[model samples]
Target chain A: MLLFLSFLAIIMIASSHNAESKVHEIAKLNNEVRELRTHFVDGKTELMRLKMESSIVKKMMQKGLKRPERPPRKIIVKN
Target chain B: MAVKEKNILNRLYFIAACMFVFAIAVLVKLVNIQFVEGDMYRQKGQERVFKTFDIPANRGNLYDSKGNLLATSVPKYDIRFDALAVNEKDFRAHIKPLCEALSKEFGKSVSYYDKIIRTARSNKNRYLLLRRNLGYSQYMRVKKFPLFEFGANRGGLIVEQRTVREHPIGKIAERTVGYERRDEQGYYTRVGLEGAYGPFLRGKEGKRKKQKIAKNQWKPIGDANEVEPQDGFDVVSTIDVNIQDIAHHELLAQLEKFEAEHGTVVVMETKTGEIKAISNLGRTKTGRYYEKLNYAVGESHEPGSTFKLMTIVAALEDKVIDSSHVVDTEDGKVKFYDRTVRDSKWGGYGKISMAKAFELSSNTAFAKIIDQNYKNNPRKFVDRLINMGLGETLGLAIKGEGKPKIPYPGDDDWYGTTLPWMAHGYGVAITPLQTLAFYNAIANDGEMVKPRFIKEVKTWDKTRERFDKEILNPTICSKETAKIAQEMMKNVVKRGTADNIRTDNFGIAGKTGTCWGNYGKDKEREYISSFAGYFPVDKPIYSCIVVIHRPNKKKGYYGSEVAAPVFKTIATKIYNDIPVIDEVSYAVVESNAVVNSYDKYYQNAQKYKTIMPNVKGMPAMDVVALLENMGLRVKLEGVGKVKNQSIKPGTKVKINQTVRLELS
Candidate 1:
C-alpha cells in the first residue's frame, strides 16, 4: 500500500509538470498567432491604400490614362 | 587534597543540575515554536511562492460589411538592454556590428547609437531603451541582431510586449474606427465603434493559480484554470471601403483647394439607411488634414439652403403653395421685422415660380413665401418640421451625436424675423447626418430609416447579434409632397444653383447651401458651403451630403463652387463604376448558314463511322477529335482548316493506324 501511494504521488507530479509545459506551449502559439495577424493586417492596409482609386489615378496619369468619360453599357437579351 | 576533592564533587553535581535546566528550557521553547508559530511561518512562505495570475483576453477585431479588417489588437514590443550583464570583452567584440545593424533597422546613424550605448555602459544603466513600440516583425528582426541574439542572460536583452489597437486602413477612416484605452484607475476612455462596443469588444479576463519554480518561472499549479477568459466578439460595421476611400480623398482634395477650416461628407444607402461612408477632415497646424473628429455626426450648425427642402415640403404638405405658385423677390432683398434677407443673385429672379424659387435657391423668395403662408400661426410651420422627426435626436450607436435645436413658437429665441430666417435655413441648427437622413427619407419615398453603423456582432463563427434596418418613421410626408420636393431638387441641378455639378449620363437631384457663420456681435462672418441630394433622379440608390466650414472668402464661398464639386466627384465615381443595362425585346432570325453547317456536320458524322471522311473545310481541332475518337491516331500539321488527309474518303479505318491531316 505504501509503495502504491508513493507511485500515485509520483504520477501526479509528472502529469502536473506535463500540464505546465503544455500551458507554456499554448501561450507561445497564441503569441505567434497574434504576430501573424498583425502582419496580415499591415499588409492588407498597405494593399488597400495602394489600390485606392485616388492613388491609381495618380499613378496612371504618368501613363496618360484618364478616367472614362462615359459609363460602360451592358446589353440585356430577353428570351 | 581530600577537602578539595569533596568540594569538587559538590561543584560537579551543581554543574550537572544547571546543564539539565538549560536542556529542559530549550525543549520547551522548541515545542512552543512547533505548535503555535508554525502556521504563520508556513503562510509567509506560501505567499512568496504561490501567485494568482491574470490572463488578459484578446480584444476582438472590427471588420467592414464585406469582412475587410478595419481594426484589430496587435502585440507591440519594447526592447531594452542590460548594460551591466555584458562583459567588456563581449561588448567590445559585438558593439560595432550591433550598432550598425540597429542603425540599418531604425534608420538612424550608427554613431548616434554608439555614443548612446557607450554613455549607458559608462553609467552602468541596467535598463537602457533601444527601441520602443516596434511591430512584431521588427521586434523579431531586432531579436536576432548581434548582441540581442544571446537573449536575456547572455546578451542582456529585455523585451516587453503590449497589445495595442491597430487600424489596417491607417488614416482613411481613423476617427470612425477609433480606440479604447484604460488608465491605472480602471477608467476607460472610448471613442468611435471601439468605444461604443467596448464591453462586447473587450471580453472577460481569466485567472490562473501558479507556483514559483526553478529559474524564477511560474508554473500553473493545476491542470484546470481557475477562470476561463472569453475573447471579445468581432463587430461588423456598415462602412463600404471603396465608398469611404472615395469620400475621404475627394473631401480632402476640396478642403485643400479651398483652404477650408474643416469639412465632412456622409454617404448613406437610401433604402437601408446604412452609412456607407462618413469622412470628417480638419486642417492641422502643419497644413495637413486628418480625421480629427466626427464632424458629420457631432457638429450641428445652420444647414443654409439645404433646409429649404424641409420648409417647402412642409408648405406643400399643408396645402399652402403649389410648385407653380408665384413669388416676387422684390429685386434682390426683402425686409422683415428688423433684418433683411438678400439673394446671392444681384437682380433677383423676380416673379418666378415657387419651384424655380427653390431651384435658384433664392433666399428672399423662400423667406417671402414661407412667411406669407405661415405668418398667422408660426407654430404650424415649426410643428410641420417637428412632426417630420427633424427636431429629435437620431440616437446613433456612436457617442457624441450633436442634438438638433429647432426653436418652437413659445421658445425664448423666437422672434418676428425668426420664422423667415428659419425658413431660409438660418435660425435652426442641424448636423450633416440629420440632413442626410431627411434627404434619404425623400429618396426613400418619405419612409425614414435610422442611420446604422454596426451590422453584426460575432465571436469566431458564431453570431451573437445582428442589427437590421431600423425604421425611425414609417413616412414623414405624403408621397405627393415628397414627389414635389424631389422635383424641385432635380430642377436645382438641371437649371439652378447646382447646374455646374450636373452630369450628362445620369440625373442628380440636390440643393446647394451657402450660409454665413460665426457672425457674432462683433466678429466677422465666415461662409459654410454645403450640398445635399440623391442620385439617378428616377430611381435613387444613395443619398449624400458634403459640408465645408469656413472656406477662404477670397477664393469662393458659394455651395456650388466649394461643396457641390466634391459631391459631384463622388457621384461620378459611383456612376462610372456601375454599368447601365439596356434591355431590348427578343427577336429570332432564321439563318440558312447555320442550318447548312449543322446538316453537313451531322450527315458526315453519321455516315463515316468506320471510315475517314474528307474534312477539307472543317477546323483542325474538330477533325482531330473526330479521327482520334474512331480509334485511329491523328497527326496534325500547321493550323486552321484541314487542307488534306492521308486517308481517302470512304476508306476503312483500322485501329492503331496513324492518319495525318494537313491544315493551313
Candidate 2:
C-alpha cells in the first residue's frame, strides 16, 4: 500500500509541472498574436494612405498623368 | 529523625498542587486559539494563493461598406529598464553601445542618454522609463538592442503592453470613426459612431481565479473561467472610402482657397438615403484644416438661398401660384416692416416667372410672394413646412445632432417680417444633413427617407442586426408638385445662379444659397455660401450639399462661386467613374464575304502539316498566334492583314525555324 501511494504522488507532481508548462506556452502565444495584430494594423494604415485617391493623383502628377475628363463609352457589337 | 520526615512530605504536596494548576491554564489557552482565531487565519492564508484576474475583451473593428478596416484595437508597448540590475563591469561594457543604439532609434543625442543612464545607475533606480507607447516593430527593434538583448535578468528590460484604438485611414474620417474613454469616476465620454454604438462595440469583461506560480506569471486554477468574455460586434457603416476621400480633400482645398472659417459636405444616396461621404473641416490658428467637429450633422444655421426650394415647393403645393406666374422684383430691393430684401443682381430680373425667380434665387421676389400670399395667415406657411418634416429632428445615430428651429405664428420670436424672412431661408435653423434629406426627398420623387450611417452590426461572419432603408415619410408631396420642384431646380443649374456648375456630360439640378450670417449682432456682416441638389436630373443617384462659412470678402462670397465648384467637382468625379454602356439590338447580319476568307485560311492551316500550303488574307494578330502555338516563331512587319509569309503555312514546320510575315 505504501509503495502504491508513493507512485501516485510522483504522477501527480509530474502532471502539475506539465500543466504549468502549458500555461507558459499559452502566454507566449498570446503575446505573439498581440504583436502580429499590431503589425497588421500598422501595415494596413500605411497601405490605405498610399491608396487614397488624393495621394495617387499627387504621385501621378509628377509622371504627367491626369484623370480622364469624361467617362469612357462602351460600344456593343452584335453578331 | 521522624519529625523532619513529616515536614518534608507536607512541602512536597504543596509543590505538586501548584504544578497541576499551571498545566490546566496552558490547556485552556490552546483551546481558545484553535477555536476562536482559526477562521481569520485561514482566510489570510488563502489570500496569498488565490487571485481574481480580469480578462479584457477586444473592442470590435469598424469597417466601411466594402469591408475596409477603418478602426481596430492593437497592442502598444512601453519599454522601461532597471538600472541597479546591471553590475559595474557589465554596465561599463554595454552602456556605450546601448546608448548609441537608443539615440539612433529615438533621434536623440547619444550623450543625452549616456548622462541620464549614468545618473540612474548611480542612484540605483530600479524602474527607469526609456520610452512610452512604442509600436510593435519599434518595441522589437529595442528588444534586440545591446543590453536589452539579454532580457530582464541581466539587462533589466521591462516591457508593458496595452491595447489602443488605431484608425487605418489616418485623419481622413477620424471624427466619424471617433473613440470612447472612461474617467476615474467610471463616467464614459463617447463620441461619433464609437460612442453611439459603445454598448455593442464594448464587449463584456470576464473574470477568472488564478494562482501565482512564479514571478509575475499566473496559472488559472480551473479549466473553465468564472465568466467568459465575448468580443465586441463590428459595425459596418455605409460610408464609401473613395467618396469620403474626395469630399475631404475637395472641402479642404476650397476652405484653403477662400480662407474660409470652416465648411461641410454631405453626399447621400437618393433612393436608400445612405450617407456615402460626409466631411467637416475647420481652419486652425496655424492656417491648417482638420476635422474639428461634425459640422455636417451637428451645426444648425440659416440655410440662406438654398431654402428657396422649400418655399417654392410649399407655394406650388398650396396652389397659390404656378411655375409660370410672373412676380415683379421691384428693381433689386423691396422693403417690409423695417427689413429690406435685395437681389444680388444690380438691375434685378424684372417681372420674371416663379420658376425664373427661383432660378435666379431672387430674395425680393421670394419675400414679396410669400408676404403677399401668406401675410394674413402666416401659420399656414409654418404648418406647411412642419408637415413636410422640415421642423422635426432627424434622430440620427450620431450624438450632438443640431435641432432645427422653425418659428410658428404664435411663437415668441415670430414677427410680421418673419414670414418673408422664412420664405427665402432665414429666421429658420436646420442642419446640413436636414437640408440634404429635404433635397434627397425631391430627388427620390418625394419619398423622404431618413439618412442612415450604419448598415449592419456583425460578430466575425455572423450578423447581429441589419439596417434597411427607413422611410421617414412615404410621400413628402404630390407627384406633380415634386416634378415641378425638380424642374425648377434643374433650371437653376441650366441657366440660373448655379449655371457656372452646369456640365455638358450630365445634367445637374441644384440651388445656390448666399445669405448674410451674424448680421445684426456683429459689426461686419459675413456670408454663408452653399449649394444643394442632385445630378443626372431625370434619374438621380446622389443628392449632395456643400456649405462654406465666412469666406474672404475680397476673394468671393457668392454660393455659385465658392460652394458650387466643390459640388461640381464631386459630381464630375462620380460621373466620370461610371461607364456609359451603349446598347444595340441583337439582330444578326450575315457577312458571307469575310466568313469565306476566314474559313479558307483556317482550312489551309489545318490541311497540310508537313508540306508548304497557301496562306493569305488572314489578320496579322491571328496569324502570329496560330503560327507561334504550332511551334513556328513568326516575326511580323507592318500592320493589318497578313499579305505574305517567308515560309509557307504547312512547310514541315522546323523546330527552330523563324518565319517572317509581311502585312499591309
Question: lDDT of model 1 at residue B236?
Answer: 92
The local distance difference test score of model 2 is: 0.89
**What lDDT tens digits, residue by residue, belong to model 2 across residues B1-664?**
5679779999899898888888888877777767888788777777787888889888898888987788899888889889988777888999999999999999999999999898888898888899998988898899999989999989889888888898877787788878889899979888887888888889989888988788977778884658888889999998888889999999999999999999999999999999998899998999899989999999999999999989988998898989998999988999997888888999788898899999999999999999999999888888899999999989998999999999989888888889999999999999999999999999888899999999999998899999999999988888899999999899999999989999998999999999888778547989999999998788899999999999999999999999999999999987787788887768776799778867876775676555545557778766765676566778889998878989855457666568888899
Cα displacement (Å) at residue B664, model 2: 8.6
Q: Where is model 2 more than 4 Å wrong at Cα?
A: A3-7, A72-79, B1-45, B81-130, B141-157, B213-218, B223-225, B581-664
Q: Name the best candidate (by lDDT).
A: 1
> B568-616, model 1: which lDDT tens digit per residue?
9999998787898899879998698667766777777777779878888
Judged by TM-score, which candidate is best? Answer: 2
* DockQ, Cα level, model 1: 0.57
- Model 1 vs. true fold: TM: 0.84
Candidate 2's DockQ is: 0.57
Q: Where does the lowest 10-residue lDDT sum fall in candidate 2 chain B?
A: B607-616
Question: Could you give candidate 2's per-residue lDDT for residues A1-79 as a string of tens digits?
Answer: 9999999999999999999799889989988888788888878777777888889999999999987799888878655
